[model samples]
Target: MGAGMRAARHYTLALFDALAAAGYDAPERVPRLPIVNPPLWELGHVAWFGEWFVLREASGSHPGEALGNSLLARGDDWFDSNTVPHRARWTLDLPAPGALKTYCREVQDRMLDRLAREQDLDDALYPYRLALAHEDMHGEASLYTLQTLGAAPPAALAPIGQDLLPAAVTPAQSGDGTDAAAGDIAFDGGVFLLGGDQARGFVFDNERRAAPCRVAPFAIAADLVSNADYLEFMRCGGYQNARYWSEAGRAWLMGQERSAPRYWRRDGDGGGWHELRFGRRSALDPAEPVRHVSLHEAEAYCSWAGRRLPLETEWEYAAAAGRPEFRWGRLWEWSASPFLPYEGFGADRYREYSQPWFGTRQVLRGASFATPARLRSPRFRNFFTPGRDDIFSGFRTCAP
Candidate 1:
């Protein structure tokens, strides 16, 4: 937990450094995008979160138990995400970046000191694990925020981004440079254990009630949809053709006047494609998985290709049942499933985490290239609104 927390902090700090490079010198100067938090607020909140759950709250207390003041003066008013409105983050009198860094270091040191003395395992460490996972999640969001702002990724994260660049292989090459598991992999699909349980340490609230779910025998793509494949749809007038899109998708398409994926641009005279990644423009690697596409876009592509998005159950069953052959963790693959709670779902101490967003979002399985390794899990259900293409997300297809 300590290592993970420390790593997450460093990663987040580096992302802030990237923002500094982009010339966002002050908190209010950072654009107030709905998809992101003010950098200063986010950093302070992460520290306050660990301190709130790990050090301030009494041991053996219920999540709702109100107790203790924060080390930071009026920290709750400033850093409690549940209470603080998103827009207000920019207007608030947040401490300077240097001070936030000091707070983070102090809180981390205290949290680590506390963790070192704990002897219990699994459930006992939930609060600490939650804090780590929370920070890891924000870390990924910070990277995408950089992409959103057209800022370069921090040098420390270059290796992670480089891993996604396509090798010198044909566009028809299989996902991740392997020919195996190219097309759809058929699953017999019987009763499969869906969701996480206490046995899996630090299971999220939405991932509870590990029940046996009966999934239909479905054939799902072994690889995520590649850029080359998606390009075919676009070149064939996929976006212009309403027949390939749903009513909602057509509305979104019409609103954006989108001719290609968010970052894509037509290459000069040759008429090939290139995309902007972290402010650097490069040729579109056809072999790389198409990312930053929304659920609506994925759905439209499926319609054009006579395919469908896999249900979350089908995705999980295949991921668990199919071993080395099923490749993921490159992008957060969108699932057809809505972001709903499992049976017997109960909110954890941090009630705002999952309960509020249920039924209003779509579920995305798997992690992205920007995702922290510690947070990557097939069972980790990521949710976003259907029209949100700002996130590092993609899709795989299922045979109709």
Candidate 2:
């Protein structure tokens, strides 16, 4: 848990350092985007979240039992995400960037001081783990925010690679002589446990109510669809064909009026495609997994290829029960399931985290390259609306 917190802190600080390098050292310098929070606000909110759950709330003593004060004046007013409307964030009288960093340091110090005195590791594990996961998520958002602004990649990331850290699936892991996207893997599916329990430490509220789900036999792609695969789709007029798209997809296509994936363009010679990654443009690696594709685009590709997106249940079942040949954990993989609650679902201490977005967003089942290792799990379900293509997302297919 401590190591995870350190990693999150390091990455978050490194991103701020990158911003400082790019003349984005102040709150005013960071653009106000609807998709992301102000950098200063994000830092403060993450710190306040730790303080709220661990320090002020007495390590999640109970759901509605919050009765302590914050170290910072107007911390709740400035940082409570549930209360503070998104647009109002830029208008607030926020502390300077240096002051926000000091607040972050103070919060981390206090949490660590308390952690040092605690003896029962199990009793106090949830709040700390929750804070770590939250920080990791915001850190990932900061990266994409940088991408959106065409800023440099974080100083902590690899200079040449698009990821903070790229984890590749070797031939041994894929059980094939070729790359992960080579072929298909069949699953003779049956009953599968679809969620987490107390046995799995720090299970999210949305992942509770573990129950048996009967899964049908299906064959899923051994790996995610690659850029080369998507290239074929585009080459064959996949974007122009309305029959390949759903009603919502067609609407999105018409709204976007895009002929290629976001951040992609043909070379000047008109010979090949290139993708923009963190302010750098380079030739697309055909073997690399196709990312930044929306769920609508993934569905369109499925139609073009005569396949289908796997259900969230099927995705989870395969990830948990499939052979080593089934590769994942490179990019966020979209599933053909809506984000819905399980039977007997109830909100946890952090009520606003998952309950509000249920049924409105699509389920993304796998972790992306930007995802922290500690937060990566087959049961960890990420969600976003169908129109959001800015995230590090891709898809594989299941035989219909």
Overall lDDT per candidate, in order of appearance: 0.81, 0.81
Q: What are the TM-scores, per candidate, against the unseen true structure?
A: 0.92, 0.92
Per-residue CA lDDT of model 1 for 108-227, tens digit only, reads: 998899899887787668889988998888888888888888888888667555444211211111112123234878766677677875675888889998787887667888889999
Question: By TM-score, who's the top model here?
Answer: 1
Candidate 2 positional error at 11, Å:
1.7
Query: RMSD, each candidate, Å?
Result: 4.9, 3.7
- Per-residue lDDT tens digits for candidate 2, residues 1-400, read 6666767877887887776777676667778777877777887888888899888764332334565777789888898887789989877888887888888888888888877777766556777877888899999888888887778976557663444332332111121122333387776667767788557468888998888888877788988999999999999999999999999999999999988889898899998989998878977999998988999999999999999999998888777753566677878999999999988888877877889999899999878888877777778899999988888889999888
Candidate 1 regions exceeding 4 Å error are: 58-66, 164-182
> Against the correct fold, how does model 2 do in TM-score?
0.92
| Clashing pairs counted in every model | 0, 0
Model 2 segments more than 4 A misplaced: 58-65, 160-182
Q: Residue 69 in model 1: shift from native, Å?
A: 1.2
